[model samples]
Target: MGFIKKLGYGLLAIVAAVALFVLLCAMNPNLTKGLSEILYGKDGNSGLIGSNTSEEVSAGSPGLSTPAEIGLPAADSGIDASSLVPYMPYNGTITTIPENVLGRNGYTPVTGTGEVLSEAQAKETEESIDKGSDGSNLEFDPEIYPYYAMLDSTCQALYKQIYANACDLVSSFAPCKIVNTDQVQYTFEAVFADHPELFYVQTAYTEKYTSDKKVVEIDMAYYTIANDLENARNSFDSAATAIEEGARQFPDDYSKEKYVHDTLIQTVVYDASAPMDQSAYSALVNGRSVCAGYARAYQYVMQKLGIPTYYCAGTSGEDHAWNIVKLGDGYYNVDVTWDDTDPSSYDYFNKTDGDYAGTHVRKSLSVYLPACNGTQYRNLESSAPVSDLEDESSSPSQPVSDAEPNHYDPYFDPYINNDPQKPLDYESEHPESSPTATNTSGNSNTTASPSNAAAQLAVYGLKESDAVTTLQDYYNDCKVQLVSCGMGDHCFYNIVPESLFKTIESEYGKQNYLGGYMNSALKTIGASNCNIVIQAERLGGGYYRIWHNVYVW
Candidate 1:
């Protein structure tokens, strides 16, 4: 367990403590017997997690360099020597795909046009998303064209209908005319591929009416896939609930992105050996996964937040996956997989096309996605012009008052030690040594003032970076409570006493209107991120109460 997991001090802190069990179960035939035949078939892991200066990186280095003039023969165009690194799987074995043999695969070029456009310019060129279904540039079987190709509204609609059915997974009962069979099955695969939520399925086979080829029948094997899919659903519920709550306080693309980004890398580990590492099930429930799982998990969480994010695939040494996210004014690349490493980095967080030039390249279905050109979100925290985000001055719960206000600190860190830079109370929660250090990239801020990290760390026993993140959140807005006395599972408990507020709820008879008052108190102390939360509660006659004033880190 890491420092963050012990206190559960994060966006659903890295929840992989029980991963060993997951790995064991995945290898048991009774559990994963036919699962290997899913999407990737059987991946023989011949390599291990790639070594890097960072805590965990399986491919290229963190810094992006200008792509050299190195050009492979036309046949080798898609290969980026960097993609040669070996990756880890759920089984702890390393998988290494030979280099220089990938790219331009087979595919139908997007239509609505003629010429070409580089990925950076994908949006500027409308044709980028319009595919022609040439079939030559395709990767998946032509019958499964929808797997990696774009689809029209009519085709997409048909695809969804079949996907809506709960099938054997491989044999979803699908029927269509012989002439339309390919289109129907391709659409079905597309629907499944697009919905990473279908964590247990990868490939599909149809049982068509031999008497009538026009009518295709699919009887997917559902039993084998149901349990894993069920587990996946449960994970989604927990993750979605937590992320939605966070998004409510900080509504905006940047805030949502950070919240999701912080939550994922904080909880999941980049383990290629992880069974189902290629699926969201591995990351969310199993707790450890490779890049693909991490990317899908990030995509799922961001999508739930009302953000438009696409699962962009490309090669970064081996067959790799990442994301194309829309932020502020434009789209940018975000590789949660690579950033899963240490010293918390923003290198691939929100990057322009130029950043990926030589080291990265998009392939298959991902090629149709919008190009990433925005650079504003590159340094998410520092780049955010707070003036434009939601106002943090007033609490959504508390009303304004004219009388003197009693501003107090909410002390939530149950563990505090004498050491300034150490994590407090960890002796009881996670007593083991060599815990992971993931709270590295604290909120970025530019000011003439130095941070009060040392003091905050001493009082809370959190890492210096953790203090900074809390400070950033606290400084941005005081109305919202950032910390609370939370249990190991992230269940926080802290109440407000009604005597402290003039408006316990708002005029419409709302609740917790004390947000405005809380911000006022934080403003008094030049509030940064605070760890203790004490919120206002509605009492009779428009009175607001709190257990005590929340202590700031």
Candidate 2:
């Protein structure tokens, strides 16, 4: 009897303990996740970690953050969100129509009836199409419309029809030819890539085709229609005009490109749910967009500036968009979208193929675009400008001889071991010489001369005022920190006001600017063959912290 009583109490205690553990698991999600992993291994097979059971992971899961939370921009045009999802169900629809031939009364009717024609009528219509039935009179400059140029004659005719109809807000029309639906899709994409002004249209469309695979009609989708389109265009133009006017203040293409890039980063915010997020209008007017909108806006503005810039679509983890810009004699890739981050980095801006091989791999038609190798203007803003340099727009490949007095190789080749030319003012000798120290590489290394000598210092938890305001001061501070450390390789960190940070970040991207500081420190530590890496982060409340990692051999 005692044994039975003891067993009953033990059972009750076990039940109580199980209930308490369940309660704890329900209360603490991390504990629940740990328990799930223990039960189902780390692939999240228990559905607690990788499942989309919660709204937080609705966009696809395995991570605690959603697509927006992790800063994944919306897929570019032609790339639906399905492309972003892993193992997303694809519902392929096969449009089936009668195999009968399409007979049109007029030269490609503005509207389609999909009427089946008898043999006699079909033969007559084909004859008329072959004759002077005024099919599509389309023309595209290869330089201005590179995508359009890539299409075959049939696709080009369809592209022209789509472009004309979309510009006029003609929603539905018969295609110029009886091509397949896949061809129609390809042609529409070409039109979209060539014409950024047609910002009201979406990347998707509906088509009527026969079972024989002949597309008879197409209906273009639109984000805004009729009057709404005019309003959107006005807003877009206003914003673009403001950007263009601001960019005009800069004299060179590099400066103008940088200005436009910075302006977009400053104004636009990446929003996955932004309306018409694939259109340039969403970015320029609404100030909200994904990678597609950013790319289109950039293409539009750069085209207006008479620069050859094309929208590039590809996969960066998921579907993405960027730009390929013509600078100097060659082309370079610019991804303002990725650079538009919390810290606003130049990590992806104006890079070469070798530079973006890992992060951005072009796909589809974007892969056919020119390779980016514009060494002269890759990071021109970071290099010290030489006076009387020939205009790149007119003389893109003008040779610069090393014999020129003030000329330095605009192209930065890190492989070249440039001997350090110690500044005369390195040891404070000849302190009276112009107050600007000139290195043999022709880069000016000057001390801090902030407009205001008494700016409160903000970096490194320093209370004492350090009048570091200009880029010169920022450069000097980096060198000073490296020399003070007495280490051949060290990470120099500094924080300054947002304005100064912007200036520093721009120059820091320059190989020459970074090399100057590294060389100065190398000279001090008696080392050679150095490398430098820069990292800048935006700390809120109008402050930014920059780190310069210098390594010397």
Candidate 3:
């Protein structure tokens, strides 16, 4: 009887120990995840009900939803679809909306880890928020601040809050108002995109929300600790100031912009593992960074010099970031990271949308950025401008009249400009000696019209109208125009019939047909790659004007 009682007592003790362990796991959320890791391996299926581990708590605990529930936007939401940038997770995967939530209006979920706060926890977190003034005095220019301009008034206010907090390096704060995960995410992104000076803060943030899912607390992450922030800022300012001062010495706007571009390429080396890889500080101070660092560095210096430069994030085979600078009146794309190749290249310097068609595509809120169409300053360093190639006054035979812009004179042979070897004055100096043109005598060396005019005739081949009727003809017309214009860096303009306008535009989206046609022309010039950008506009009478800026290498 004594032995039996002893064994029973031991078993009872064992059972109590098991129950205590279970109770502790239920209370501590992290304990459950730790158990999951032990059972399923460190990287195993930690998710039982939802994807976000922070939201995944034991049964009956008040927890946030996984994949974070985003309600449809209200009818009065006024959220532009373009303004909704995708949330990029720290692991580098893009967080997508659930299939069920597609087409519904709502905010996008910001990518980060945080918990749904209890009422008491919310009160505690709220107290920690610094109500101090730091970035309150900062002003934003709507024209220059593309991301800020995308936000509605409410979100704009949130942007100011996030910006101010980040500038001050406030560890945690309550949002100025009750905002969903979507507004917080977008506003946070806008703040970073618009302001490159917020280098210490990281993109991922932690949010504590009420059980009802209203975000109550935000903890902004930082790359630099508070003690080291001032030193980092001083270093950043020194480097940026030096670059800005150097750029100001240049005589023209293009020269100053180019100087900054060249300086960045020379200073920064592409290092994916560099500390603070996303911040301009990494590129400017450490001399090592990835695409984000390069872009932000360019943006900061240009903005300091009072050049309107915006950071552009997108995908180029992988995630990438670049800049769009307002040189003169038009915006032009400049990828300092890409141009910093071995021996350096101007492949992406001062390019247009058509110039970057397939290679670089803007994603998220960046799509709303102005289309880079400025051609005046493109490739200025690599080659002489067409105006510099020959004397414009030398072309007396084919005089350009301001009133008759499109007036074609077959006898004058305007295509003579296509040949770089032949001087424009050659025709006037030695009229009969010119190979590309004919003298006033009706006897002509060339039987066809000029490049552009002849291509126009081919598109309207035997048709009573001037529009391209089929996709095949449209493709052929573009290639012929490029080839006829000597396959050099030039713009090839074509008009599509109203019926085929949308279809031709669709081909550009497909990306295949344009490449095939551009490549065919490229082969003639003995170049393997080319920068070809096609921009189109709708004309009255069902006609569409399409133009291609083709630069071959």
Candidate 4:
């Protein structure tokens, strides 16, 4: 019995020792690390499980064991780790109102019922309810109201606000469209409401007119659109005759003007042809055109008629060209081009007297006619008598010297001065001898000298060539000077008498030697008559270059 008790005691002591050993192993860092390696199937040398091991082992290495390797629940084996985790709602709260509550509030569901309100409830609503005497709560039936009326008043207000804002933005960016003559005139008329002060009136008999007389005098000078229309009545009659006569009398001049005029007249019908240019005339001998061609043809004809007329270029929707004629004290705007249109419609030939005196007005004379100062001609309206402006003076008014041809008049031809070659007094000098003299500018008594003429021609010819070559050389030299002057890749050459460059460009194509290079070079040297040496250097990784130069005349 004693031995049996001893054995039982020994067994109990062994069990207690095992529990103590398990606790010591759990607490021991090294022992616990080794146990983890055994359980996880990690290599003993790996630092991952065995803390004392120095060998590095990555968590995903083949030698390391994860939960799946130890016969534990695997990721895809119908085992959900999330099922073991705490539950959380995706969204904490609901936001939508209940349908029951909406219905309770007397709001019918759109999909459920076509009825908006109960008949009794609608009847109870007042026809004209005033919230605070400001006429705010005016109720109307939704079904009976217009579709647009059904829109919320707030929405209508917002739409108007947006439209106004958009319009303001557009007007700010493109003021030209808003403040144009058409718009301004319309607005002015609306504000004035036919007020007498707004419109100009002639002086009353009781009042002695000061500026009014000047205005009348100016108006008298102006050739009215009516006058032009009357003149046009005769145009068709004389047109064929004039063309044939012009071709016969002045073939070269006649063909040039005729070609241009005929083309304009033909093209005036098409509105799409508005804002045309001289090229339009050259394009079709008789094709559709606009005001530009009309103005050009008018000027051309007037020039042939010995009238001093200038072509004016200005802004009018597109680039528009008109005419300015030298009248007595100042230049007057005579848009024969505009006048040619119909009085009733926008037809090119029907612009009436009322239209000219009313719509399609012009301002800023300098913008188009550079020669006519804007300040001087701005108020000086067109006043040339229609007949006088169109008429050609007959007879030899003055002897033609070296002076430029007096404004040529198409209506009449002036006599050419006598040729100096056949002297008028030659018959008296040698009564029996036949007169023999040429209209030459050389000394009369001396025999013509070929050497002298040849020498003169040679010098003049060489001077011309030298001028061009000098300009070319200046451009080349200036290119170098531009470098040190802080101007890079930019330089120019300016030659005296600007026309010389034009002559060169005309004779030699603009793309010839020194053309492209000279274009860039010239901008640097500017418009000075001097030889320049320029140097250029690249700037900011772009094609731009800074240039500097010195001028030598």
For all predicted structures, in order, the TM-scores are 0.42, 0.50, 0.52, 0.19
lDDT accuracy of residue 421 in candidate 4? 12
Which TM-score value belongs to model 1?
0.42
lDDT of 3 by residue, 1-553 (tens): 9999999999999999999999998899899877787666454434443334543222222332112221223333334544443322122232343332122111122256679888998887788765444454567897778788877777777788888877776787777766777677777777778888888888788888887777887778888444598887898899999989877765556666877877787778887678878888889999998888888999999899888999887666556788899976488998887777665656678898777765666655666577787755565443221121134345232211111223232322332121121133312233444322332233553333344334434443422255677888888887788777663467666766645765654444333352447557756756544554444432323344565656656
RMSD of 1: 25.8
Instruction: Estimate every model's Cα lDDT from 0 to 1.
Output: 0.43, 0.58, 0.63, 0.29
Q: Could you give candidate 2's per-residue lDDT for residues 35-121 as a string of tens digits?
A: 777765565544545443433223343423334433332333222233233211111111221122111000110122344445555
Over 4 Å off, model 3: 1-110, 127-137, 383-553
Task: Decide which is better by TM-score, 1 or 2.
Answer: 2
List the candidate numbers ranked by TM-score, top first: 3, 2, 1, 4
Off by over 4 Å in 4: 1-271, 274-277, 280-284, 344-553
lDDT of 1 by residue, 1-553 (tens): 7985757765334446346557876678655534433422333122133222434332223342112211111222222223232221122212343232232111111111112334434333332222222222213332222233355434544454445553333333333222244454445545544566666654344443332223334444432436676665676667656755665565346655766775676677676577766567677777788777877777777766767677665565456678778775578888776665544444567787666665466654454456677744454232111111133322122211111123422221122121111111211132222111111234321121223333323333433333212223432333433333211112122222222222221211211222333334444546432223233322222122232333342
Candidate 3 root-mean-square deviation in Å: 17.7
Best by TM-score: 3
User: How many angstroms is residue 186 displaced in model 2 relative to the true structure, after the best TM-score fit?
Assistant: 1.3
Tens-digit lDDT string for candidate 4 (371-463): 332221122111111111122232112211222232432222222222111111111123222111221243232232544333333432322
- Model 4's TM-score against the true structure: 0.19
